[model samples]
Every structure is written in structure tokens, then in C-alpha cells.
Target: MSTISLTARALLLDMDGTLVNSDAVVERVWRGWAERMGIAPERVFAIMHGRQGYSTMAELLPARPMAENRADNAVLLAQEVADTEGVVPIPGAPAFLTAIERIPHALVTSADTALADARMTAAGLRMPDVRITAESVSASKPDPEGFLKGAAELGVDPADCVVFEDSAAGIAAARAAGMRVVGVGARAASLAPTAFAPTLERVAVTATADGGVRLAVSP
Candidate 1:
């Protein structure tokens, strides 16, 4: 496959599937919740990734009170924070972060500050100076709030930003923010992001002379 090239004034990153692989903890916690709630596990799993816990709970139990979802979401977040046995940095993630240290970039994740810190630390990844965590936004992924906030914080036009994501919600959020997306991993392939890569390992980043970032993504 030909290499896909992209340029941007800044880069927006998603944490869970993009930088850290926390699927193990996510599945364990959400699966248990599904079992207790008598909901189908597959349905719960379908919308779990790349979203804030409370948002997932709300979607899974739409008729349930927001208060109940928020309460349960808090409990689930705590459980995820405490369990990091399988959390690890995505392939090339450490190098990718290092490569962008001097470039304009911000983490746009659905995780709250605590969970973000825990997972990033567990994966041994450097946290970006600018981060839009769950607490920073009133709306979740697929809403564009987080990505828009990240672009604003980075002082870059949304159209000049490139997003790296691995889930449907994240890609949609980036698109809604009017940014180009370099979809990462299997989850993003079918989402029709501007570009696609199987892993961060297939992506190369460089600083452009115009104070932008350039990405060369392999198929």
C-alpha cells in the first residue's frame, strides 16, 4: 500500500486505544457490570471504547436515571484505576510521544484526570502538557467538544489539526471538530478516517518548518 501523508499545525491524541491498551481492565469492569445489570455483554462492549464511563452507562441504560449512571460510572472508573495488570503502551507510542515533545499537541481523551494519569503512568507514557480530559468537557466523544477544546488549547485551527484515534466515537468527534484523522488500528479502519494505519508503529512524525507536524502513515 502507498504511504499516506498528512500535515497539520497540531496533533490531537486519544488515550485508550491510541496510546495505551487498557482493554483488559475495561472489559473486566464493564463485563461485570453487564452481568449484574442483566444486560447483554456484547451490547455493552460495542459502545464502551473511546467514551467516558458515564456516557457508556447512559447509552447502555438509557431509561436509567442520570444520577444512577453517574454513580455507577464513578465506581467503574475507580475499578479501572485500581486494575492495571494488562495496561501497556501501544506499539511505538513511547517513541511517538517523544517525537512530538516540541510540537504542538494535546491529549483529547474521554478519561477523567485520575484515570488518565493512572493509565498513562501504567503504560509508562509521557503525558502531554495540554490535556482535555472528561472533566474538561460537558459532552463526550462523537460530540466534538473534547477535540474542539484540545484544538483551542493548542492554539491551532481545527482544520489544521490531525487527530489520531482508534475508535468510531473518537474519529467522529475529530471529524465533527473539522479536523483530519489518521485512524489507528483495526477499530478505526472501517470508520473511514482521512488516513489509516494498523498501529502507531506504522506511523512516522516530523516537525515541519512552518511550525506544523507531518505524518507519513503506512497502510
Candidate 2:
């Protein structure tokens, strides 16, 4: 197992590609939206991950008024919640979640509460005790609001939390929140996170002799 230093008292995790496999459902729903809006599906896909639907729609449909974009985004989100069949846990997510439950952990996601719950339930993964959804933050990923809110809800200092993230937005949020970040996907390598592991399955956390925890990434 590979190892890295961690100075945190808690863990903050991102829900989508980091812990669950909802890419198919996300892409499908966004593709439909792209068709309806006459936007490029690939462009929509590129901007939507780790971002709020409203934020994504605003970015994708910049010509549209915010009210119109919000309405369209709500429709798409409703469709996704209604069609949650394809959502599943990422490989080893169950085991990783179980392992971390012994410690304080929170889920910080760009998704709102309803969609976050739907995806978590569909994946058969237990929701974290403390969760900061899009509804809980005025600013989203790459802004640090979500991660900071999550740490606050868990009653931990931002510097006392370790964040597990899969996207550049999330990594930026964690870093801005003064947390150590473990990047958990191929894209992670480019983010220059504190540690980069291919998947959560390859990550391990253990108590250190100094009474803090150490995070390890298995090669």
C-alpha cells in the first residue's frame, strides 16, 4: 500500500463519480436536455460534472435568461430523479464507505438533496451522517462553499478534514477549504492533489502513532 500524510480529523467525500456510478444516467439525461435546447451534448457533458444543474444550464445555455435556464434545468433534474435505474455504487464503494463509517465523514456534492438521496439510495450506499448538498451552499464546487459547509456541519475545522474528490472542481473546493485532498480518478492526476489514487478501493486510512490519521494509496 502507498501512503501519504493526513492532518485531518474527518473526511469529506464527493458522491457521484467518486463513490457512485451515475455517469450513464447523468449523460443520458443531459443528452436529452441538449437535444431539447439545441446544444452540443458533448459540451454539456464536459461542463456538467461536479456542478449544480442550474449552474450547468447557465453555462451551457448562456444566451437564455437565468429564469428560463432554471426552469429547463428543473425539468431535466426531475427526469433524472424519476429515472434512477442506471445508478450504481462505484467498485469497492460499499467496502470503502463501511471502513470510513468508523470515523466522522460527510458527503459534499454539487447535486441537490433530492437527487443526491435518489442516487445514494439507488447505489445501496449509506448516506453520510453529515451532508452538504447544492441546497446547502450558495456557491458550488471550485468555490469551497460546499466543502466548508460540510466541515462546519461536522464540527471540524477545514484544516482538520480530508476531502475525497474525483473532479477538478471538487479538488479546488477542498484545497480552498484548507483541507487535504485525495483525488480519486484518472482526472485526479492532473489536479495535483495531495494524493492520487485510481479509485477509492485503492485508498486506505489508518491511525498514526502521533494520534492523527494517515492516508495511503495502494499502487
- Candidate 2 per-residue lDDT over residues 1-219, each given as its tens digit: 456656567889999989988989999998988898788899888767787777888776677788887787778778888888789897878988887777778999988788989999999999987888877988768889998888888788888888988887788888888888888877677788888778878877776565446677754
- Judged by whole-model lDDT over C-alpha atoms, candidate 2 comes out at 0.83
Pick by TM-score: which candidate is best? 1
- Candidate 1 lDDT, tens digit per residue, 58-105? 888889999898899899988988999999999999999999999999
Clashes of each: 0, 0
- Segments in model 1 whose C-alpha atoms lie over 4 Å from true places: none
Each candidate structure's TM-score, on Cα atoms with residue i matched to residue i, is 0.98, 0.92
